[model samples]
Target: MDVQEAVFLALDLTGTFVFAVSGVLLAARRGFDITGGLVLGLMTGIGGGMIRDVLLDRVPNALGQPIYLAPPLIATLLIYLIGKHVSRARIWIVTFDAIGLAIFSVTGTTIALGAEANYPAALLMGALTACGGGLMRDAVASEDPAIFIGTDLYLIPALFGAGLTILAEVTGLLGGVVSLVIAAAAFGFRMLAWKLQWRVPQPMRQWSYRETGRRMKKLPSVFRKPD
Candidate 1:
């Protein structure tokens, strides 16, 4: 592979490795056994890429390259061995996960673009590659997926990274540096959200029962209305 391809492959593998580590750590925190950690880690590491490949009508990279499976298993083994001493594993889950997510966003978008996908499809594949694995991991673990179930900055930053990749690819400018910047920005955004405990706004009014009752009192009761 040329330098660009080599660089992207390294980034993709790094993402897989870190995502596996995050999954294993989370499994440890959830009281899962080593085997469970292994399962979750493997799922989290390669699930997104597999899903993206299938959606794109291509062979899953992990399937063809069995070596890709090693990272998650190795990560699980490491976490199981030293998880107790690493009291900060729980907190580090977010950090590792964020980094993995950012890298996956860039890698996925790059792959999709290389496959001749349009910008929109490339953007979507980027998100899938960043999130599909986590979704699978959470479902297997019987927990909520952090990206969609909460106001976490995960999906937003991933989308931004994907969008940036598309823009750079289209313009043929900063093609090499774009992925790096996108990954870094995405990581920073995710870390800041976690640090600030930021949340996405929803349609929730957040009125307490007392407030609801007060508001109700202002309206005429049906009993007092003409029957």
Candidate 2:
């Protein structure tokens, strides 16, 4: 592989390892056994890329090349062996997850652009590739996925990085340094959001049984007309 390609691959693997660590840590925190931790780690490391590949109508790199599986496996085993000694597991999980999110955002957008996808499609792919893994991990663990629940500004940082990557690529400014800067910016933004507890706005009107009942009471009056 060329040097540029090699660098991206290295970044991708780094992201995979960090994401795996996040998932394994989460499993440990939730009282899962080693087997469960391994399963969750693998899902969180590779599920996003698999989803991206499927969307792009290509074979998943993780499945097509066995080497793609190594980082997650290593991470799972390492965490399983030393989990008891790890303090501040939650903080570590969030930090690692943010790193993975940032790296994957860049790599995914690059891959989509290479596939000849348009800008919007590339952006969507990038966000998905960063997020799908964590969603899968949460699903397996039976927890509400953080991205959808408005727990923090998760997807926004991914999008911000992806957007910057796209801008750089289109402007012919994309390089190792640029990519690293974009990823770092994204990571910083995510961490900032976490520290601030920033959240996406909820629906202006929340629907609930009580609201529905109140509306129903008004509904009959509208049907009765001019009594």
Compose the digit string of candidate 2's lDDT tens values, residues 1-227: 89898888899899999999999999999999888888999999999999999999989989887878998889889998898999899899889999999999999999899889999999999999999899899888887787986758889999999999999998999988889999999999999999899988675444454555554333355567675
Clashing pairs in 2: none
Give candidate 1's TM-score. Answer: 0.87
Per-residue alpha-carbon lDDT of candidate 1 for residues 133-169, written as tens digits (9 for 90 to 100) = 8888888888777876455667888898888888888
Positional deviation of 170 in candidate 2, in angstroms?
0.7
For candidate 2, the TM-score is 0.89
Deviation from native of the Cα of residue 154 in model 2, angstroms? 0.7
Clashes per candidate (backbone, < 3 Å): 0, 0
| lDDT on C-alpha atoms for all candidate structures | 0.85, 0.90
Error of 1 at 76 (Å): 1.2
